[model samples]
Target chain A: MKKQQSRPNILVVNDDGITAPGIKNLIEVVQEIGNVVVVAPDGPQSGMGHAITIGKPLRFDRVDLYPGVEMYKCSGTPVDCVKLAVNKIFKGKKPDLCVSGVNHGLNNSINVIYSGTMSAAVEGAIEGIPSIGFSLDDFSQEADFGHCKKFIKAISLQVLEHGLPPATLLNVNFPKGDNLKGIKICRQANAKWAEEFDERKDPYERPYYWLTGVFQNNDKGEDTDVWALENDFVSVVPVQFDLTAHHAIPVLNTWTFDV
Target chain B: MKKQQSRPNILVVNDDGITAPGIKNLIEVVQEIGNVVVVAPDGPQSGMGHAITIGKPLRFDRVDLYPGVEMYKCSGTPVDCVKLAVNKIFKGKKPDLCVSGVNHGLNNSINVIYSGTMSAAVEGAIEGIPSIGFSLDDFSQEADFGHCKKFIKAISLQVLEHGLPPATLLNVNFPKGDNLKGIKICRQANAKWAEEFDERKDPYERPYYWLTGVFQNNDKGEDTDVWALENDFVSVVPVQFDLTAHHAIPVLNTWTFDV
Candidate 1:
């Protein structure tokens, strides 16, 4: 028998469950590049942050969602799906790269803190694997991802060729389908949500609340993810799991304590 | 007439509920330092992970808990408590410092990802204030915060004098009531939870799961928070909210595609 070439195993995951059009599009893109496997949540889990299902036994089903590409539907958080796929499902065989999202909306700025899409990517980084989270600035179910396919292929190939720095992953957000600008490697902008809760009465006259927020970016800097997305560019921000503020350690050491 | 001196205002909050003994002990220690104002969750909201109550109406109660201190119990997450305290409740007056936890257990290593206690402190830092989250390794209602009081007071007074760096907070973890070996200013080690979900049956025979995990430390460096805690010393790690991985930007910039 002739020696066979080894193909890179790519694990595709997303926060918007297994059946979302976002992941379906992502799967099609991955199939053109490498041997792909998808293990994602069964339902939408947006704003889940880096939360893992510790208080629940996760159930996973080997579903035939993406034909030819092995897929599993997991009943857990996005982080859980990544953990199960890496540890239990793959066992000792590590995937060459992990890609999450093509998320329905942008996970830019501080929104990444509460994002299931980004959390799946962050989990991959924590496990020392090269990973990327993709999101569109548009949140519509019918949003066009036609413009993002080429950029996704380029980024995925780069990651596969040159493995990412340990403890780092990419947060790639596409500008709302518009005329081409370009991709900008940027930093997370100084931004936050100005909360507005919508309260309405149910049929039984019981009040319910819906979370709403307006993005507030006071920073006028041009090198931020917010600025890039605003200029119709794909923002590629390298994100890490370590939260340490290395610059503050010296300042903390100077305070006088009675003890 | 002589003007009366206002006591140093200390805002006390935690991931554990307002009624937990941990906060009670925290209030007592803070009372000795200055005036205390507590705004914490009405019930236990551990593992909330910086989640704000954006989709709901918040209600608060001014309760008689700490005799001389003003306290409010809020129907929200820990991050919500900090927000309400800063924007709505305190109005124009900013506190000298915000303190979260004296939490029932450890927030060392990667546990800080899902920590509501640290999230409250991080929120405070975002608001341009010095903040700190203190946790003991013990997870008991009556876990001894006694031995850690001196260290806590020492650190708090230090932060009060020398403010933290912009967008940074301290994650301080004390080993559960043992003879202290002083303090260690350490970096957060690379560690993670080896999660094992325990499946159980409810009285109604429905299966439910509880989150359980064992802390696994792969890093053996002496300069780590894990090493400090293992050596019976209090570990202080300066944590930041900026999730961007700056080092990976150069690598991402090399990626190319036809735009």
Candidate 2:
């Protein structure tokens, strides 16, 4: 009798829906390393952050998209997709690893807080699984993802071999260029989007606003993700879901709160 | 000639919708200290992390709910409420302080990542405003909030007097009790929701799932938000929008990624 070996099960998720080229490219790369199980949003969920659908009922449908891989399209946020996979699909059995995105746009610096792609990976980390979120610095639907496969595979393999630290996941951003520099492990830059709303009138002449913003980098730190991305390097930021400002705790403790 | 002293402008937001008792209580307290401008979701936006409305058009209607306060009900997430208030409602003039919720439920520990209430404050912090998010441990719509006003006012006044550290906001979770202990400035407890899906059949005979979870606190640290909340103390956690796990960067740098 021949001994059978089981492949590692990998849960792949993205914010750019199930049919997006970014996730398709991600699936193609990760499929080589494990048994891929994709549970992603049914539609574009960009800027959705870590939202989970509570007020509305969630529906998921199995689709035959990839050969030899199980795929489910979820009518919920990226975080909800992870929950559905862990609880309903996998029946509480944690996967070997979770990978989110090859996101349509960058989730670097301040964008990490507003990224549905990174949020999926963060959700995976919260569920006690090593996770990585990949993104390219391109927003176009026709953006090329050819250069991202090697980096994605390298990072995925690394996370699989050595699990990420507790409560932490990687936010990997690929610079959009032909001659790509190597990966750089860096911290999130102190950067923000200067919001500018485009005010316009609806058919009823009521004013409506469209959210738009310009990325502004105020930090001059060379070891930051923004700096690495600008230098054509794949910036790998070890992102944590713990929002605690540990340093500020001591300062706040000093203040008397006698109302 | 007497110099006219202008009251500090405060932006109030919540995830429990504009008409929810939580925001109404929040507006009532903050109005005592500043010029209150309430821009909150029109409907419940619970579990809506740092989500923003990008794909869909956002509409906000000026509502006259609170006396001597400007209130707007926005058709977007809590984070969207912050953006709309900053860019459109206030017309780019940053408010002196941004406060979100007397949230119906606790946003302690890992809950902060999935909280629309905390996300609103995080958004405000990203936009360089001194911000704070308040939540009660109770989840009932008719939960008593009389015990939270003093702590809320104290924290709000503190943030207004001495601005928070750059890029940092406060996640304040109040214990649901009549005799509440003093505030404890603490870190986010290492905790997570152990997801349990309640599978059921819809009207069409297809299976649909409702997301339910158990709060699991594996961290035994006393200086944590969870510990503080459980001890009948108001947990004041200084939260930051920067997702970077700074401690893990050096460890990741040791790993070779020469693929």
Candidate 3:
């Protein structure tokens, strides 16, 4: 008989703080596959893309939030939680996998650029761990995540079995509602937020501005994340952190810079 | 007679706070090209990648920092400065170009993923403005920037004349010495910071940690940004915010995920 392999060690993190129901549901699903460790932000960290706490001191303490799982609440951003887990908690022993979110809202298309949920997975990829970030299309305090449990387990198990490519992570977005189609491998849609500042007076009558934006999708490609999500399919865009635009190098080299 | 073209409006921003000498030198060089508007963070915001202010209200006010230049100091991240400039100052009219950071330190290779300097430029590109972020290999309060002035002007003028490719910006890094080679268009190096947290105690004897890391570059390709910078060439890596790893999708599609 073949020797049974040891269980994989999985690091769980999120942007929606430790108490959010989304992460709790994720923990329940993943714990069946491996030994899970939870290290997440203490407060809501929506849109805090790739941010690390540099100017301030960081604090993380062990918590009993989930049954039969080791968990900690971090007083920092989502990226900081990953850093802390890697450097302090794990003590330089890299985990078998790092998974972030089952985030409360959508992280589709251009939203990935501004997402703390996706940034945690990006950080994990940078750390040489097979990683994935999961998000739902709904934005509610009590968002329904029932449709995501089986899908999340399947994806996580596949990553554990197959492993991911270097410098890459999966940005997975699930469509809202229970009647879901299968997953679609897609690219990031060329989309953006058209920002408008609602200038208002504070209690002391000083003028302040609250940022509000409308999601604008201009890319009409059928193989985009936005299109897949709109058609009720789970969209998975493989994300890499290397920002180099390789196609533009030849054009840039032709320009003269002699002064 | 030829019709006279109006002066281009340029937006200048940085992560090194409003009074940093790096930005001051940049302003002096770019002012000769067009009408200048500066909106930058009031404090240092290094390693703050693509972060936006959503929890608290933001405050910004006009300041007289440079002669013949309009300036504003914002109480937010580098990305916030760009958004405020676009919505509040420019009033939805896109500037001719946006330039961020003649930075005090280098944003080569993996540093670009965590850099507030490059994040500002990325924010600009997302807003459909041609953008460039410049950095020096040296990290000092009074680093010599005389050698960068002419080069900065040349690059900025080129971007203004011929705008960048769709959804792209430049990550330009200069070598630390006066004996400089010409510019090299390169790709982002495959590199990362090996982090080590220094555990220490506070005044009350509670333990806290400070993040410190050594940059590890294993990529040996001469066409990479790290190689170009190490060889004393000004490296320009055209960067895009779309994190999609298009090459990895085919492999992922073969994996089984049926639950």
Return the top candidate by TM-score.
Answer: 3
Off by more than 4 A, model 2: A1-6, B1-5
Estimate, for each residue in B1-259, the C-alpha lDDT of model 2 and write its tens digit: 8987688999999999998999888888988888989998999999999998898788888999866788899999998899888987788889999999989999999999899999999989888889999999889989999999999999998888788887899999998888887888899999888887777899889978778889999999999999988899999999987788988988898898747
lDDT tens readout by residue for model 3, B1-259: 9998888899999999999998999899889889999999999998899989887878888999777789999998999999999999998889999999899999999889789999999999999999999999878997999988888999998998889988899999999888888888999999998887777899999888788889999999999999998898899999998889999999988987875
Alpha-carbon deviation at A258 in model 3, angstroms: 2.4
Candidate 2 similarity to native, TM-score: 0.97
Evaluated against the true structure, the overall lDDT of model 1 is 0.83
| 1 or 3, greater by DockQ | 3
Best-to-worst order by lDDT is: 3, 2, 1
Instruction: Give the per-residue lDDT of model 3 (tens digit) for A210-236.
Output: 888899999999999999999988999
lDDT of 1 by residue, A43-110 (tens): 88777677666434667778996568799888887888888787766764778889999999999988
- Spell out the clash pairs found in candidate 1: A54-B211, A55-B209, A55-B210, A55-B211, A211-B55
Off by over 4 Å in 1: A1-5, A196-211, B1-5, B53-69, B91-94, B197-212, B257-259
Alpha-carbon deviation at A88 in model 3, angstroms: 1.5
* Alpha carbon lDDT at B221, candidate 3: 100
- Write down the DockQ of candidate 2: 0.81
Tens digit of lDDT per residue, candidate 2, span A1-259?
A: 9877677789999999999999999999998989899999999999999898887678889999878779999999999999999987788779999999989999999898889999999999989889999999999999999999999999998998888887799999999977887999999999888887788899999988788889999999999999999999999999988888888877887787756
Task: Arrange candidates by TM-score, descending.
Answer: 3, 2, 1
